[model samples]
Target: MRKTAHRMVWDIFLVNMIIITGMPGAGKDEFVKVAKSMGFLDVHMGNTVKKYAYENNIKIDDTNIGKFASDERKKYGMDIWAKRTSKYILDEDITIVDGLRNYEELEYFKNNYDDIIVIAIFANEEQRFERIIKRNREDDIKSYNEMKSRDDRELTWGIGKVISLADYMIVNNKSLEEYKSDVKSLLKTIIDSRPKIREKLGL
Candidate 1:
């Protein structure tokens, strides 16, 4: 019984978490899709906020959604989004958290999880803008000025700092196939590193 209980504890601690941080339209969704295909459970912070807004009947436009997210941070502290989204994490051995926008959110995961990896995806502004335009999500800004404003807002939330401090970075400025290949390689590296991590933990 003692050995079984100890093994259970080790298994629990062995779970690995990957947090994805990037500017809007920087291929985070694509990364999440790849991570999902690799069997990592996905939790998107922006989707959580949007769900909350929909539940409360808040307008879901770009400005309103941004304000709602900011208000949530102000009301519940800078880690509010992280705290809220964390509830979706289950007993999965690997989980991919997408849409981390601030350093406080990263800090929350660092303080809570023993095995956490931060991956940042980056693209040139022009590339990102073109992707955003092509995606045409209702909440996306329609103009370059609006996109710039959104970038400023996100940067103010410490996204740039989070990206700078990432454990790994994927530059998504190339073709789709190239980006996907890079993501797949990174995922394999992360998955391959897990056994070493478990060994070090005496699991």
Candidate 2:
């Protein structure tokens, strides 16, 4: 189809860039929360998929629709989401992003933004699966296997490469207090390490 060709061509034409990656329910959102509370802004890529799903009346429970939203993104590239989220970055002093799963998406961002940070948050597979089942955003997924399927789909979507190339990693496997503490500590380190963060904000 024409759509598929566009995605392949876009990938070939675009440069690969930095991105933070992890499976669903890995506290990518929570990390964003910590960042925002500490003066950083937050944006989520999944909002793009969710918005497309909503406009088309694609029930969150529709696995096929989720597949379509993801597939359609391959051609135009996830920068579609990055472009939207970029608007928020301009409105803030510091920013953090949630829901990255492909290198092309990351590249689109790094090429446009300066001093971008790619932080990956991860937990054990079992924990992430349990978290997804409980989230139950889609009634279609009610078992361990169903959650596994979602994760596998993301992996196939190029999530692994993003994770492997991350500049930093956070493993979420402890109490919320501990995780929050780690976030603060890690963020401070990243801030100190990246001059772009301070330079852009005039800090």
Per lDDT, the best of the predicted structures is 1
Looking at model 1, residue 179 earns an lDDT score of: 95
Alpha-carbon TM-score of each model against the true structure: 0.88, 0.79
Off by over 4 Å in 2: 1-19, 62-65, 84-88, 138-140, 195-203
lDDT tens readout by residue for model 2, 1-203: 01223332222212112244688778776677777676676666667667767887777763765576576777676556666554444422455677777787788677665446677888997878767766666534667777778777878778888898888899999987899999889987876776666554455
Provide C-alpha RMSD values for all models, in order: 4.8, 7.0
What lDDT would each prediction earn against the true structure? 0.83, 0.67
Candidate no. 2 TM-score: 0.79
Supply candidate 1's per-residue lDDT for 138. 78
